[model samples]
Target: MNTPNPDTPNRDPSDDDLDHTVRPHDPADASSAPQRRFDAEVIPLRPADDDAPVHKDEDARAADIDTSFEVQLDPEPGAGPEPVDDGIGYLLDDPDGDAYPVIPENLRTLGGVGEAIARHTRRFAHRIAFHAVRTPRYGVLALLWSVVGVWRLGNRQLAWWWVSEQDYLRSLAVASGDSREWYRLHREVKETRRVRGLILAGQAFGVLAALLVMVSVAPWWAWAAVAAVGVPWLAHLGRPEDHPIIVPAMTVPRFRLLNHDVVLRAYYAAGLGHPDKPNQQVTFETTMSRTKEGQGSQVKVVLPHGKGFDAAVNAKKELASGLDVAPSQVYLTHDPSSHRRHTLTVMDRDPLAIPAGKTPLLDCKPRNIWQPAPFGLDEHSRKVTLSLLWISILIGAQPRKGKTFAARLLALYAALDARVRISVVDGKNSPDWNKFAMVAYHFIRGTVPNRAGDPVRQLIDALAEIKRHIIDTNEFLSTLSPEECPEGKLTEELCRKYPKRLFIWMLVMEEFQNYFELPDQDDNKQVAELLSFILAVGPSSGVILLSSSQKPSGVGAGDVQRLFNRYRDNHAVRFALRCGNRNVSDAILGGDAYSEGFDASALPVGKPYLGVGYLYGATDHTPTVRTHLADHGDAEKILTAARQLRERAGTLTGYAAGQDTTTPDRDVLADVLAVFGSDPGLHWNELADRLAGQIGDRWADVTADAISAQCRDLGVPSVDVKRAGVTRKGCRKQAVQAAADTAAAS
Candidate 1:
């Protein structure tokens, strides 16, 4: 019924001819209806057997060169002048040697759950804004017409003035003379504005006219419209449908314009092209395949914020009807209000989405997704329980995944709890731990003892002392009186008066792998022994070991078995971040467990899964716990509190205390004096020999390194080692005899 306006010379893009060319659907079919989306027309599939070979190099791509020189070979013919075996191989091979398909550049995959949420939110906002405001198609036409009108008027005036100006004036004089001619000059402008205003006025008048017609014939039109609307509505209600209104809307385009506009906006923002064409629309819904149960299809749509809710619903119904999916499956939400701001409302088709007693996992409230069944708290209680019971947690993620933020949250949890004692050792010198320095009981920054000083050696030595303390404590407790048993004697009153075990002690090693690995089995075994001892008995002694690593390859699993003989029994937990290594998840959480549950690989930053060993009926259960690292205020409070407690104690206990608790037999002073009296460059072998009778060989390396590194860091020049021997100056006079002997020997 629409026609081009003669008054307007130019046509707006919206009024221009739409491309409706239909391509052959499926070649095999030779007869299928052509489908259109936005602007791109998709032909129906002909169902031809698509066994065609993909075009590629006939010869398989040449094999890649091995980086290792162990199997060097002569170069093949044309192998790039002997030194290179054809540069082509290097270009094709993956540098990391991973075989998985590379992520395509054009796909625009979401970075994480956070980015996913951000992405959907942005789309939602953009759609809402777009749907609320319409571009003026008529204004564009009006401007073009005005230009043509001016040109035509100018030509007419020019011709009249040249042909017979006086005669034309005479003719015009009969009807107001030159004034009439002058008025003609402004006629185009006046007429153009008049036409535009009429067009604008027509819209209101048309609405009023339509309403009047409806009222005048209300009895008749109402029945017919209801019949039309009801037919589609009943069909959709009766059967799963994608767009019941598709047939009706096609016939009633004018009435369905608002619905189409909203749908277009939603789909365009989502990158899901409008169903009518290929390009996306700001407000439209897209179709996903049906569920396994064949309940209905998964529908995604965005309803811009502040837009009429009814319009959005109508669009959703249209799309849902066409897809043959339930109306409830269609999601309607807001779009990104601006370029950066995003919003999303996802409706799900699964019945189990909202498990019993659990809150729906949605970014915004007022659940948009529909699940057949409702969930309760019982669905998530097991995980919630684990998070509360375990105080200090260690998290590891591949870079940029959210490990540090999660750690900070966990630290915050400890601070908020008030009873947990937490310490963090950031081995990588990352800036993450710097902000929480205040709340951490012990916040160690940079590599401990420096890279040159060898922090690994220092940590191993420290763990040795903690192990010794455990053994001694166990022995002492074993000999206690019946009334002095753990239940009666291991009280806070007893602990406050003593140095340790008043509260639970947790040592969080950010990258624990650094300490666990050693150059030789002996060193490795010693470190393992220390770790096993802690893991086995620390729980009883009020200590918990929480360590994090990128991968769990070199952690003390084998050692845990050998030493504790409790391989699976020890409660050492692990959490992997998007690891390709399936073995890790299987080893920690049982076989194929992560497959069904939350994928740790897909974990967003600031979120992590907690794996526990059969503690809360979790037979290798790995439950996700939101990691909340300690904030600045809480970190400060914890650190300040620890500092005050340590200040009152007036000493650094646990190995650094210099109490000689681990040494036996001879006085440790004799060994120090023996080293000091010798020549300046005493070789370690010779020093070990001198202290042989007093100190065992096992203790030699540990003791010498500990004493030497400590002294050098403290700036004490008591004993100096050189290539030749050892030297001593500013020696404590109390070691005179041993120093004189060393001086005489040198």
Candidate 2:
């Protein structure tokens, strides 16, 4: 149970009553059931037969006469005008369209066609080799079965010619003492045997004739061919039905096309419709058809009048069960034309197994950070791209599910652009992020000190530097002319002109949740504040924040917890891979994604499913992406090239350049308490005078105003204190001691 973030001064007082995290209890009562998720609330279905509910018109609701069109408007509006109909009795605004494209979407691009060919080639070669390896065994089985087939065929012919079954029937009649039946059976058997004997003799003569022709006119190879064909036939006949001499090297599953009956039955079984009820059965507004690639079947389904897409989505698992397929194979994409309409695509096989192949970065070519980077492919084989500019990305998953790899991928993308300054911070101190140090300006690992200096202090320094840079960039942009900065934001041209000043900065934090729960309360809060501030205002300043967390919830208590949740939820884009449960998935992707039925926890389980997840808030379609794999070698190679690019561009600095980025001693907390002495409290002027007197040269420039602001940043509160019967603002020794202890513990 998480609470909403603390309100700012601008928040409405009345809005305080809206406690979204919990249910409203009766004023006179104390307890209430735990808050229910909106999706869990059962929606009442209007199963009665009724007319279709009218939908709101889009064009009517749109404000068409905006600034560009206001002066050139053809008409004005008080209430929206009625929709005009064409002469042929159709509303021109509404057009019938097919979701399927003319060309196979995956084949529209050269890469897609090449990938398809390569995939098929790989599959074909595998099948060929698989069968080739088992050829000798197959031949041995055929020869063994053929020898038995010869004796079996001869015995069957002999029995047919001798009328063996007729003799048995005659004996049975004789035992029953039926003379008439025995006489009839004997007459039929005698006649049948005579006819069968003549036919058998003719078949032998035919065989002899065929052999003589093969021995004379036919070549030796022709006889071999005949034997080859005849041997397999004999083997087939001798073998049991279950056992075959030859078997398929690969299994190809067959899928039935989705027609009206199949689609309707699935919906009815899922309780979305009633087949026997009048006007309550699910119907298809458009004809059923195969997907562009012919890999699956798709249909335009419309639920009963009262039921919308929600009903179908909520019952998606049930629908998959009813259709006898895995839930991952069933995709329900909402149709924008109608609330009742949604497209259902049922795959023939598990789609998660489809490989996204390696990353395009394998070529080690530089990519523009402004353009969307090639991330991976969706379940439908559509390419998914990630836009790194002006957006903060959050990656969350259970440990060992490729959470670190996902964040590393984005960092590697930004690194390719030489102008992007990179900072790599690995809280868990894993080797997965080690390669990133090649391109990072500031690289820090774990909480303890390393060759890179103290990790915790270095991280604080990196964040503070980024925070200051953001403010500087904003101030510079504010002073720019419209011609210099058209969108009133950082642009590629501007950054290029002044690379050092405007170049993009990317901060990669792996296992960031560990920082939030640091043993030191003040350090935890300081890190949270700096990160929260940077995340809220960094993007417009060309700052990119990429944070990965295995534990996104329950990191700390009170303000730290609230800030962590707020910061985690505020990311512009989130990619969750193999979350432990729906709650974890929701925590990563937000509840809106879960409501839309894209649960990361539902991702197929297997080694192949690793690094694959639900990518939401990045594009219009929420795609389950199989992220492009970048192994350790790949990361090293790509990042080495990135380091060279930065060197060539004269963009290398900070840790990469071995510069001394150490900040001066910032133990302001310890200094403040030293000045306080044994006083219960003091005015700002009194504290500053005592610090100057006692601390010597260190506090020579310290002033009442300077110490007042510094104390706030150090987490020490100032208060009105009385000294010699005069009251002014200052801090007490008790508060300073607690602050120092908290910082020391972390």
Candidate 3:
């Protein structure tokens, strides 16, 4: 086929033309010079006046010359048209004539040059037509109103020259011959309006009136008036030079375009773009993409300013309305200017929610006293129900996971609920549980009593008591018909009459493995019964089981499975914090639920996962992760209140018997008896004088002891210790008893 002429009009060239056109001086250039040269076909593209320079001769020469002798056709479509440069560089392999540049003047020859300019300009203008009009409308109106007002106020006249006086306004004021001098005059005018005018006016007025006496006083008042007006004007003018216009008053067209460009750039980057740029308001869509799997894309709209906060909030509200999710799930934040740049992030999850009017009980960090238990439990009712009904719950956490805090919160919650009664079995006597001792019906620090003592018997007795209480309460509930009980709340009278029966009792065993796994085999058997009672009948009697294991598997899978079985069908509430074993998490609820319940990747030092129905298939709601024991102080306060209650109720007898260990000394008794042996009754003042050295100032202690151990035992009925207050009669009875004891011993 004949070679297509690259210079021929309407003749498209091949790739060979493009490759050869870029080479330097060659044989083809010389050979083509004599035959058909492509030089005449070369099109020299011109740059705009403000754009970069173009070297036409060099480019043309480069287009015609070829390095090899073998001929190659022009790669570009030389004859058909010219190409367009869109800022983005063009690819050489384009098949469409759209890539070819059309000659500018030639286009006018074919059509109208004016039309193209007008068309492009119209398109560009229309692209921002609404914005251009909308953005400046408010400012333009405000400026127009100001101008009209100034015109109406005769402000122009105030600066106009008076022909009658042959004086321009400048003639009365000051004059500057040149532009530089005019600016200098501006300084003087400012000072005149601000500071010197009134004084000069007053001096001139004084001269006109010939009133020397009034000059200073009038000037002072005039100056004050000028200052009052000028200061406000200056204040109005005081602002950053770049931001000279007031907010809501000034319009920033360029900045707005910049903002628009930025938004568009972000949208494009996020793969969101509008087909029509003109005639439509900018559309903002979420950046999140949806996929086939449950995992989907989400958009995080970063608001630019305070106004942006309102936008974000509104956007979230609109989304929530559309999505049917609560507004709380919508997170609005001040994002970095770029992903890398800002530290100031203000976020509002719920913009419309009013704070509930209750103080948290534990009132722990961030959480209030009444705030739901962190780690897992969220509702007091659920925690109380579990305590009231569950046999045992195993709380396993790594250290500092707020396990103790959760326990304390649970205890406080039980204390607050009248239907539930709590008793703690702590081996370490963590100070957190001490306060609960008063309100807790039974607080056993191991069955051993004090540390190092035998806790096995004490624990067994307490467990037995707890079992008795559980059985009794269930029996009582069995007796009452649904009609007899309006609400299930048990009152103190009900508990008093049926001490073991009226309420649901919670027995919290801390470090239970220590007690249950005791060295003594008999003690171990006792623990087995305790566990059996909790595992078997506790749930039926409103006895919920809550225990903690450092290792659940270590406790035996049978027990774990048993617990799983009990709670699997009906677990009311369950929570765990920083669990080490994934198996445990799976065992509790399942790996999926654990992962869903807790953002384990983001867990802080003490945060925990709470699954509502994890222990028992109770509810499908995602468990709210919370820290344990909202506030330790609330636990202490409850214990204190319980102590006060016990004290008021004369439970003092129990406490007194528990701590009453004072015994009289045998020697002191013998000495007191020596003084009173001669007389059954004696003068009290005389006896005090005689025995002051023996008993010190606390002689009443001696007297009281004598009355209690001596006089009462001797049957000295006539000499009543309360009425006669006879120290001598009581001492005589002690002397008789002591002498008798001495003779018996000898």
Candidate 4:
């Protein structure tokens, strides 16, 4: 309501005598110059009185205009200034909320209750026995500490009294402001002194009474009780909290309790969670202690949304660092129940620090080849078995890494099965497999040279023989009705029905790379092709090929390398021990397998970890395993046992059967004649059928044409004969006798 000042800046002009529209002064009009234009100002107009007189002069109206209006410029139009961000605080919330469950460290697994009880009892007994052995020393230390405690009792009590008196004097100083309170404190302090004297007198009297009882009326057994219980208790009270009087001989690793905070911290440290977001939402399901000889803890974790076990496994090193443990001491495995869940095992010590003991195959019940054979113990010290029925195994590692030993384990188990026939080719020609020759149906020591031919040629011939076995087995399988082989593959029922006819043939080729890179290109190519064929088709026909090599890739021979890759692909089960680098690990396991964390190159290289390796393609998760060690003595014992079992069952055949070693070069005429005994008059078709049934499956390709050509080469003549209802081309008794005589003379 007050009138505005014209001299003030930024002030609105008075409404009286205000013009609604004011234009700029025209340069042509001199009188317009004195009239100020207030175009920038917006003023309200007031209605004039009804009786007011009107003035027509423009100069008079313009002289009342105010000049306080000024134009205010605005900023240029463009992108607006970015908003000031006070960062989101919810993202930094603590991840250890009650929303997630807490898993204990002793109740994770649901099955194997019996095994768990047995393991716990063993550990408890061992710990008690270990501590009991040193009880005498601990007892002596306890007695010495008790005597020292009695000597220091008086000094300790006096020091305690002096400290208490000092505290009381400080309280008196605080209450010095009030004269009445100061006098009251003096009386209280005198009473405290009297009470302290009475407590010290009682302690002295108690000690005197105990000594008097021990020397006079108390029994000798009472003294023993005091020494056993009283001494140790007193010693414990005198010892410091952090530093115990007695130190344990072994250093036991302490596992961090599995709780929400520990798990979230681990997830964040492993880079699986972001600081700008809530810690990866995890559900701690349950936990279990390792039910084995080793000391460790197991935690089952259900990962956050959109996460998987592979991510957890890939961050294994980070997790171990977060938990303040070694990488070898932590193990991450997938949960069988859910894809989003995983089991995290943290060990107190490396399980591979000790060599694996002998297997229990000799003591347990006999296992058929159809069932998985126990190979070794996994990283968690759980039994690991492998199925050889429909799979081939390729073992690769550096020298002295237990490549031969692993292969021998497979062969030994196969020999124990009465229905399984083993063929061992020790390419190194070492005595490692010499004992196996006792039980192997077809055993060839490649270390020894063949006097009559090239060694490589002999090796090639041995492989060819295996290929022939595959063809024969296939033919025999074709003759069986669908009822016998429902899946058109070898079954255990069929194996038991005709144990001699349908055998599980296992071929163990040690140093197999040598055969594939032979100097003779022809032999190398032939051996490669035969081995590839056997690996591809042998499993279905009950044939297993276990091959070991020091080098897995980059062989000088192109054909050999190609064959190696082919075999590697077909070998569904593979084990790689302490390799030199990632390249060798990937080559043996598979591309990306090493990156996926199944790194054999990470295995420790020493006698204790000699048989340690990463076993892949055998289960859903890759596991570090220590294969059982079976020395020469163990091998001989196993072979002797297996041979005796085979002899009792009448299942031994081939070279193991003690047959003529010269049968490899004998003509078909002599073999057929041997089957004939006395009767030699038989048709060619009849001869072929008899050979097929007698020689198992190797002679399945013996047709009438093959028979007539071989008979003519052996100087055996064929004549027309009448049999049954028609005359057919057949051999006469006289002609067969002449051919046998000629073969012997040669």
Model-by-model lDDT, in order? 0.42, 0.80, 0.44, 0.71
Q: Which residue segments of model 1 deviate by more than 4 Å?
A: 1-394, 412-423, 435-454, 479-502, 518-523, 554-569, 587-599, 602-622, 629-746
- Which stretches of candidate 4 lie above 4 Å from their native place? 1-133, 155-168, 171-183, 199-214, 239-251, 256-323, 330-356, 362-365, 447-454, 556-560, 592-596, 603-608, 656-663, 666-746
TM-score ranking from best candidate downward? 2, 4, 3, 1
By TM-score, the best candidate is 2
Q: Model 3, range 1-746, lDDT digits (tens) per residue?
A: 12223455765544323422222234435344433234334433222243555444754544543221333233222233323335566456642122224454325453557656778888777656655666565355444444454454344334322112223444534454455654555665665554444655665687567545556456777757755564434433443345433343234332111123443444333333333544222343333422112122233343332233333333444444434334333333333243211111111222112212122443322211122332333321112123233334555555555566665655665555443556677765667567665565556664444553445555665566556656666667667756664454344445556543454566676656566455544455555555565667776565655555444344423443343334332333445555665665554444455333332222223212321212322344433333333445666665565445445554432212254112222444445565664565544444445555555432422223222343334433324233255334322454455555765687
- By lDDT rank, best first, the candidates go 2, 4, 3, 1
Displacement of residue 262 (Cα, Å) in model 1 is 26
In candidate 2, the residue pairs with backbone N, CA or C atoms under 3 Å apart (3 or more residues apart, or in different chains) clash, namely: none
lDDT of predicted model 3: 0.44
RMSD of 2: 15.5
lDDT of 1 at 76: 25
- Provide the RMSD of all predictions against the true structure, rounded to 1 decimal: 28.2, 15.5, 33.2, 24.6
- List, residue by residue over 1-746, the lDDT tens digit for candidate 1: 11222224575655333221223224343333333333122222212234534224322211111111111122222323223234454455443222433543223455555555787888778766664453353234334444555566556545443443345545555567567666664564456556656665676589689778877778976967865564434444433245222222113222111234443454444334445553322443444433222332333444344433334433554544543334433434333333211222222332212222212221111111111111112112222333323222334555555455444433443433333455566666687666444434455544456633455554555566556555666666666666656463244444444545344455666655554454434455665666666777765665656655554444544653354223222444444444444454444443444433333443322322222111212223433443323435555554455434444445333322224322244334445455546453444344445555445533543433344443333333454334434343233424345444555577
Cα deviation at 17, candidate 2, in Å, is 64
Weakest ten-residue segment in model 4 by summed lDDT:
70-79
lDDT string, candidate 2, 1-746, tens digits: 22222244677765544422233333333223332343322222212234533224534223221111111112222323423434575455434344557777778889989978999999999989998999999899988888888888999999999889777888899999999999998899889999999999999999999999887899878978997999898888788789988788787688755667877778999999898899897878777777665668888888889988878888988999888888888999888778888889888777788778888897989889999988888887777899898899999999888787778778888889998898888899989988776777888889877775677767776787888789889989889999888888999999988777788999988889888887667677778888999999998889998989988887888888999998999999999999888888999999888767688888778887888898989977788888998889989999999999989988888888877554556477787777676787778888788877987445544557667766776778888778898877888778778878887898
